[model samples]
Target: MFVFTPTPGTTWNLTVDNFTQALHRREGDEAYIHTHADAEGSYGPRDEHDWWFAFSATGESWAGTGSPAAGDHEGVALDEATAGAAAEFAAWVLRELVPPGAGMEYNTRVGMESGLPDEVLTENTVTELDAVFRKHLKASSS
Candidate 1:
């Protein structure tokens, strides 16, 4: 699991295994990846806005916004089990999550506000990653 807050108004939580399950359900295979976007509410500066994307492995490897007929957002299930699909998805996330030149700004802001080292922030983000994923799983399963 991994969590990242690229902007004040958005956060992302990703899980490698549950994502695998979702991908399996979507693609009818065990070795595939999935990506999805969720509309989550924002607080602070961007209060009342909807922004957030949570991607998990489901058996697909495509990307898009909003919900799809299969589910929400976009996903793609690759034919091969190579890391290329995951790498491409991650690259897309890195590009989409935070715009260029804003990384430093957000880092400084969050650093000062939290009064924690970058390592701690990274750890917290990762912790929240699985937490959110599990919550979603529980909800869907029920």
Candidate 2:
């Protein structure tokens, strides 16, 4: 599991293998890679993001409802760098959880508030997220 504050009022919590069993039960395949993030509360001059993704040996897919769907909200609150950090963490987690693997792909939507540009927000988010991912990666390897 991974958790970080992208903004003052918003926190993003993401998990990869935590739902493996649930995916198998719901989709009938253990080879699936699943990730989900839930952002609660409006925070720090920005909106919230809540999204999910599931990939089978078949192809890429997303989870949730609506025309755009909740998954479309994946990185709405993040800048590109922070979003990249989040995406990298998700991808790495999927790769770590599944072996004999193929490449991965994803689609994400971000919500931007604040006069600040995405590049700025992303850089800051990335700095923090990179540390978090590295910590989890080391622990998982051990």
Candidate 3:
């Protein structure tokens, strides 16, 4: 899984509420976002693309991705299905959250552990993530 966060001192004060409010899904679309049962954020098993998106309150930003609801299945793997789902999730995130021309330096990491300030890899706008989303989701009109 991968993660992102607004750099400290940035004016963007992310809250779990924004994620709940930015709920957008095409009509008849099975994709959705639901507040986690216990956590201070949201989670959903999007069956449409076998992907899921999450909001971590601690990080005040994007959480990593994995199919927690892939009930009774093998664990997270880097196969095509896993990769596709992750790509789709990332696309949805950038499309729904990352405002156009957002200049805040967003911290990022590539581990499953999110919301930690000590593991910051690069504290900058990770435009590469946006590009990757565009590449994978270009053919998807939804």
Candidate 4:
């Protein structure tokens, strides 16, 4: 799991899993991300790749949906202010590498510990995040 604070108010948390590493597959017409990577020393049983993207403000969490190419997950509800950013971020991720699919999972991690500072989303932060995303996307794709 990786946590990024691109802007002051917004935070993105990315989780990665291998296609076969998940204990259970996504059920009921849900869309999923897939990937493969080699096993690390301590982590056991690894596969190619799988990933999920999410954002949060205060205690509220939001996830991206591939369908309709927007934001909001099945369980979490986002407020008006953060909704657009969350949707934009999610949609960006989905469009970048995640192919279109149904039942997209968002807000997959809510209770997980955060390592980012508490701050409001700022334009500078968003810009920083964009650079980071592009770098990561480039590296991963290669």
Candidate 5:
């Protein structure tokens, strides 16, 4: 799974399996689902192409061309404000990625973790999730 904070108030969570299945169903291509882990203790698995992108708190961004292992999965540590923004992004992603004919099976655990700062986990969290997903899709494509 890939996790990140697209903006100050948003957390993005994504799984390779879910993404691959959704893309296959929508684009009818299976290449997007093809990825493998290179390192044993990595947070997320590395793709054969070794492409990985991550956003850090120090305003640092990382992307490279090397295989990553499943243990390489990383989480987006967010504050209350940022978490809220992430929820909105997640909602946008759901709207765009979830196809009309696609069933709930394609749904993924793409959301913030519970026990977050109450201020961030407000009623709008769902919206943030959608927005986060939208941002992720855009970034992944580009």
Candidate 6:
């Protein structure tokens, strides 16, 4: 049991720093919160964020804040808010499947991708992933 969802590439209605700060404040024992953004944002404009950063969870519980791995960008094409809306929809399906009292139990040091949605998602697994996001981006859409 236990399934997980991943965060979508949504442009939070906040400045980059503000978003980062907000994520820092978002910690809880209730669930795992994976937060990330374009790493290129650190070197370039606020809009041309292409470098992907996978972050790890620090302390107990996922606080949506952590340090990215040494490298950046997994080359996984994403649909951010300014881009396509697939991530938004994938997030929706996973959220709809979540039941009460669901949250991630494991703390991971490895970052990049969350093994979620499996090949097929079920309500049973959805409730188990804890508070996963973007639970369906990697699914087989055939």
- TM-score, structure 4 vs. true: 0.21
For candidate 2, the per-residue lDDT at 11 reads 23
Clashes in predicted model 2: 5
Best first by lDDT, ranked:
3, 5, 2, 1, 4, 6
**Alpha-carbon RMSD, each predicted model:** 14.4, 14.2, 12.9, 15.2, 12.3, 13.0
Query: Cα RMSD for candidate 4?
Result: 15.2
Q: Residues 93-139, candidate 2: write the lDDT tens digits.
A: 33343223222222223222212122222322335545644543444
Per-residue error at 18 for model 6, in Å? 1.9
lDDT of 5 by residue, 69-89 (tens): 232431222222243334433
Quick one: best TM-score, which candidate?
A: 3
Query: Residues 1-142, candidate 3, lDDT per residue (tens digit)?
Result: 3333333433223333344345333212432444344243344443322343343222233333332222332112222223234444444444555454432222222222333332222222235544543443332323
The TM-score that candidate 1 achieves is 0.23
TM, every model: 0.23, 0.21, 0.34, 0.21, 0.26, 0.23
> By summed lDDT, which 10 consecutive residues of candidate 3 come out lowest?
72-81
- lDDT (Cα, tens digit) per residue for candidate 1, span 1-142: 1222333433333233434444355446433332323355222212121122323333444332222223332222222222333333434344443344333111122233445322212222323433433443344345
Mind giving the per-residue lDDT tens digits that candidate 4 earns over 1-142? 2222223223222234322122123222343332323355342213222223234433544442211112221112222324335444434443333332322233212212322222222222445544543443344445
Residue 69 CA displacement from its true place in model 6, Å: 26
Worst 10 residues of 5 by lDDT: 103-112
Instruction: Output the better candidate (3/4) by lDDT.
Output: 3
lDDT by candidate, in order shown: 0.32, 0.33, 0.34, 0.31, 0.34, 0.28
63 Cα displacement, candidate 5 (Å)? 11
- Model 2 — which ten-residue stretch has the worst lDDT? 65-74
lDDT (C-alpha) at residue 27 in model 4: 28
Position 66, candidate 1: lDDT: 24
Tell how far residue 128 is off in model 1, in angstroms.
Answer: 23
Better of 3 and 6 by TM-score: 3
